[model samples]
Target: MRAVAIAAAAAAAKARRISGRLHATSSVRQYSIMISPHLKNITLTHSDSSIYSDDRSRPYGQPLAVPWSANQIRFAKARGSDVRPGNVIERKGKVYQVVKAQHSTQGRGGAIIQVELRDVDSGNKVNERFRTDEIVEKVFVEAKSFTYLYTDEESDSVVLMEPNTFVQLDVPKHLFGDSLAYLKDDITVSVELFNDRAMSASVPKRVTCTVVEAQVPMKGMGATPHTKKVLLDNGITVQVPPHVITGDKLLIDTTDNSYISRA
Candidate 1:
């Protein structure tokens, strides 16, 4: 019975020690939480801090995400005719892909060019507007020649193969809709790859197509033109001029999918 009592006492002592250690850890956590406000103010900007607070009107801060700055973006070449979509940009030593570009007036403000960029690694897209003359980074892309092999029957995806090589890749048809519009047999496209797979594609500046079917012109149509839509051979339909008819070739601006004029 004496030995049993001694064993019980020893176990109780160990438990007390563990309890003391846990209390010490909790006290440290509380201390850190008390000092966190000052640390946050030092580390985060005013806009960033506002995003973190419990204010419903402010933007929410993404936790544990790396911050990217638009000012750090560097342009490789001068802003000219070459500033087009699918161009990779290097900013703060990281790469981003340009998805779309639009220039518009900001309601009584000067013209601003809004750019949509997709993170090359995460495939996340963000929008930012800048002046038309603003310089941006243009990162070098490594693309190789490849050819379309066939479409997947089960998954509804198009399979591609490298020319003179047996390597093959399968991509969704929806993701390649724009490519399929002008993609011809054995045509070449600049494919941007991430982790050994094609993540995005870049096409030519402009392409010309013959209007298979054009609607009769709706003369004196109101503010909104009487838009009669016609389907193209690529399985895409777009509204065109009423004067256009079947077999009339037309040049289209592929960027905006807008009709230019009769070819």
Candidate 2:
């Protein structure tokens, strides 16, 4: 009887991991204490409800956040290692993707290397941060260019056209957030696609736009100058200096939508 129960428990654990439905739960511990010899190397399978006895209490579909710290990641030395997609390895207790590797450098750094990385669970790309001597694992991230189409009045959504293709994808307005302010008709945006759908999009790091409105200059604002709210042509409002007036062109940083300088 005990052996049978242990076998069942081991089977449950394997099932939970595979389904990705099993979250950390104490009820899972009821069967976790048992280990069956045959189930030692068993692979997890989806639809295994026996994995977590606490399923009734815990939320379903919550992803486990794996943390990877900066100190733990060391650069991989070889460009052609087994850094393939969907391989999870631990570096400094944090996990990162082996997105893509390329060799190139501007005139200054000689032929240095670059590796794009993505946080596996959060699905965010960490900026290129490894040195040329460092070898890192690869996680596949799909990239494609899409042309801005138009937004829907009812759904408050926008559309993008895939390059070289007639297919259009409907993207929610909230996903673009402030970035949408700068988008013009037919503007091209770099999109990161995962599992055949768009996950993230980015625009140029810097862009210049004409200010639609600026507040009046303040009295005795001091030599440093006081900044006030200014609306741009795209309808996004940013803080600008007191001297800034309507129809003034200014360069802005797209990274945070902060004002840089007059265009």
TM-score of each: 0.43, 0.44
lDDT of 2 by residue, 21-57 (tens): 5553334333222233533333322233434444443
* Candidate 1 residue-wise lDDT at 44: 21
Model 2 misplaced stretches (Cα beyond 4 Å): 1-139, 218-226
Question: For candidate 1, lDDT tens digit of each residue in 2-117?
Answer: 98688557555644443344323122221110113222221222223232233434342323222233223334654523456777776556666778887788887777877787
> Given candidate 1, what's the lDDT at residue 243?
62
TM-score of candidate 1 against the unseen true structure: 0.43
RMSD in Å for all candidates? 21.8, 17.5
